[model samples]
Target: MGGNATVAVEATTNRPSSASIVQTLGGGSGIDTSALVQSLVDAQFESRNAALAKREETLTAQISAAATHKSNITGFSTALSTLSRSGNLATQPTSSNSGIVNVTRLSGAVLTDVNARVEVRQLAAAQTASTAPVTDKAAPVGQGTLTLTFGTASVADGAMSAFMPGAGASVDIIIDASNSSLQGIAAAINARNAGVTASILTDSAGSRLVIKGGSGEARAFTLEATETPGEEGLSALNIGIGASGTTIGSAAADAIVAIDGVAIKRDSNTIADLVPGVKLDLVSAQIGVPVNIGKTLPTNALLQAVSDFVDTYNEVFAALNKDLDPVTGSLKQDIAAKALKRQLQQLTLAPLASGAGGAPTTLSQIGVRTNRDGSITLDSTALSRALVNSPDAVEKMFAAPSGAATTGNGLAAALGAIAAEAANTTRGLGASEISYTKAKSDIATDKTDALAKADALRTRMTRQFASMDAKVAAYKSTQTFIENQVKAWNSQD
Candidate 1:
């Protein structure tokens, strides 16, 4: 119906249409004209579309390769930076008698060798005060304020101090009938945290309340008691030197040690300041024994760091060298690829800054040499001797002070710079890969446009075919009617 309307509209307007001329129908003309038109369209468009698809595939492969190359190079640069920093170096610590006193190195703490005689006279002790044995552990001792004061007190007088000078703020523990038992008083005293710990001690004799201070000279204390008129039993908890109600532990004393014949008194057994970069822990009283302490370069740590740097350097070069392979990589013919490989190779072989006092300048001089495959190999024996003889020179070679790029900044620094450049996202290979991806995207857009035009042409051809079919059907109907009329006229004659 719509096709008839289109033809009727054109006839009413007296305008000629593209399909105005009548053509024979498929059965009448003995031809499959619609199928022929579709075949022609396919022949016109398929080859160009296949070529565009191939171009997109090639571009995508190259972009992926570039991405992988950038990742490997960046990893190499990060590892190189670890080798350039001086803080990464390890310090070796040794003690002549580890059983006597154990030592450990602290982070960021520089240790140096020192010859010293350590004499441990005594270990620091805490002040402990104990109440006299009581028959009932749960019975209330008193109900009042138990005042604790800290100051220097003589152990002989039933009061004791820690190894350090007395230092404590006065604290008060309140005792009441509700919580005045040995266990209750201990809990109350502990809850105050007034520079002391409290516990109920049970022995064969009876139960007793004990309060102990820290193991330092600054922890001396005196305990006094005041009781309410009805709670005068609390006074039994009072503690002092020679006090009848309480017994004091051994006198608190400072740890005493002599290093190199210089006497030193510390508030605790863990002594760290007697010698520079050396800590002496007084385990037992050995008044005249000398313990030797030594510090050396941490050879194992140095070896591992150097090994990692070398291995990572080889990995970066391997990624670049693969481009030279004929069949595997897309970069085989790329000039940038060759230049990158050459840059890293030259940097690895370049000599580092000379040592402070005429040491080896090149990595090869210290037992790390280039292999036939362009990777480096290390000789541990040679490196160890070099380290022993000229340790300062070896360090300067890798971690020289900041100066001119060609003169002072070490080989590690130079290699790091090249790696950074190759992997730089803003202007390096990563950026180049991004451009490649964009180009690939443009090719995709072009293919899409070409395919869309082909589809549009198909739509136009279908509509034209439909109009021509309508005209052909109408002409066939007209010819059939005229032939029947001619036959009727002959019959009538």
Candidate 2:
């Protein structure tokens, strides 16, 4: 009979059996068992690993945005500090005759409307002592312990009078076989930073050792040589008046300067204590001629400072606003960035410095106007008027230090605070990076765990499926033998 249903009978029961189904389906289980196990293991871990990867990528993007936010804050701070350090915001001290006396302001001293007259009587000089001519610079000068003592020497009637030793430690220079020659001794003395310098100068007569001292009166020194046994010519370098060619080329003397005809003596040519807020460096002596010191017109300086500050302020706000934009992907609706943006906008109206009554304290008072779009503009005429009326106050305000970050309103201090917070390692700029890195690390660890589990599943399932397939293959062979036996028995019957 032609029929779709075809089966084999069992030997004992003589009924259609599972062996017939197996034979019809082909050999064994008729499935790629190895491929099936691999697909199952891949399915278990693929979705989890993909989720971890996506999270890591998002963290990376957030860290990049944090860097951008930090850049803006620090840029604002550095720009303000540069402006203050450049001295473009202050009224510097000016000298009428800069050739004679140059003026420099050392500190944030308010020298507004202050003037002074100074006259340089004589400039300070350094003392130089030359020894007698030597036939050979490399020849032995004898061994000794040369002691140098500093003192102030006096002269009366073109002759030596009295000597007063300075209250300083005496320096002893040792001369042995290694440093016994005039050149060697000079090298030995040069090694000491004891306010004394020595060198062998080859002159018309011969080579002579010359010793020079520091430029102050207290630095004048006299040499005493204590000779060792059999050492000759050691005392030749000693000072009495002293020796044949030993002479003081220039005596170290204190500088004499006059402030408004009042005499002042200092050990250096650069004088600062005579006048407040300014240091006067004497170039040459002018017997009675006076140099006038005064303040310069800082209108142009204020103009440029105002311009730079406005532009920088605008830039900082612009970048910060972008980061805090609600719809933007980067730092969207970030609380910290939003707060910083508001604080930066407030800096335009914040007081810059402390001064006398009626001074222009804030940037707005001095003509900086904020626009609707967060940018700012300067009014040159208003700034000039402030300069004309309150010149001292104007100088006082601009001359103030860049505000600190926390304590004061100086540009450096106030702006520095914001910058510090932005890049702060624990709680600010670096905090987000730390979080993202930690998350990425966790993702890596989870991926490792997931892979380990997947590997174990693949191994266990592959072994189990192989065992099941082998048992099923044996059972099918047994069923086929029984089915053939039943047919042969029926045919014999």
Measured by lDDT, the strongest candidate is 2
lDDT of 2 by residue, 1-493 (tens): 1121123222223333344332322234667777788889988888988898888787777777788778877877787767666676776788889888999876666665558888888887667877889889999989989888888876433223456788888899999999999998999889877888998889789998888887777767788889998986778787534344376677778888888888888888888787787888889888899989888766777767767777777776777677667786566745566656767777767776675677777767877888887777888788788878776655554554532334334656677777887787777766765776787788889889988999899878866775566556656766776677789779999
Kindly report which residue stretches of model 2 are placed more than 4 angstroms away from their true locations once superposed: 1-50, 107-110, 143-147, 154-178, 187-193, 224-230, 240-242, 333-335, 369-405, 452-493
lDDT of 2 at 236: 79
For residues 1-493, write the lDDT of model 1, one tens digit per residue.
4475456545534424464232322533345666756677788888987888887886777787777777787666666556555455645456677766655544334454555666676778877888889989998787888888766556765654222234446788988878888889889888898878988889899998988887765566777788878767877777764457887875556777777777777878887776565556666776677666666676666677667777777777776777657687676765555657777667545667555566777677788877777777788887888888876556655562354475445655666666667666666677668777998989989988998988787667766665666566556655665576688779999
TM-score for all models, in order of appearance: 0.66, 0.79
Q: For every candidate structure, what is the RMSD over all alpha carbons to the true structure, in angstroms?
A: 7.2, 6.2
Model 2, CA-based lDDT:
0.74
Local distance difference test scores for all models: 0.69, 0.74
User: Which 10-residue window in model 2 sums to the lowest lDDT?
Assistant: 1-10
Instruction: State residue 170's C-alpha deviation in candidate 1, in Å.
Output: 2.6
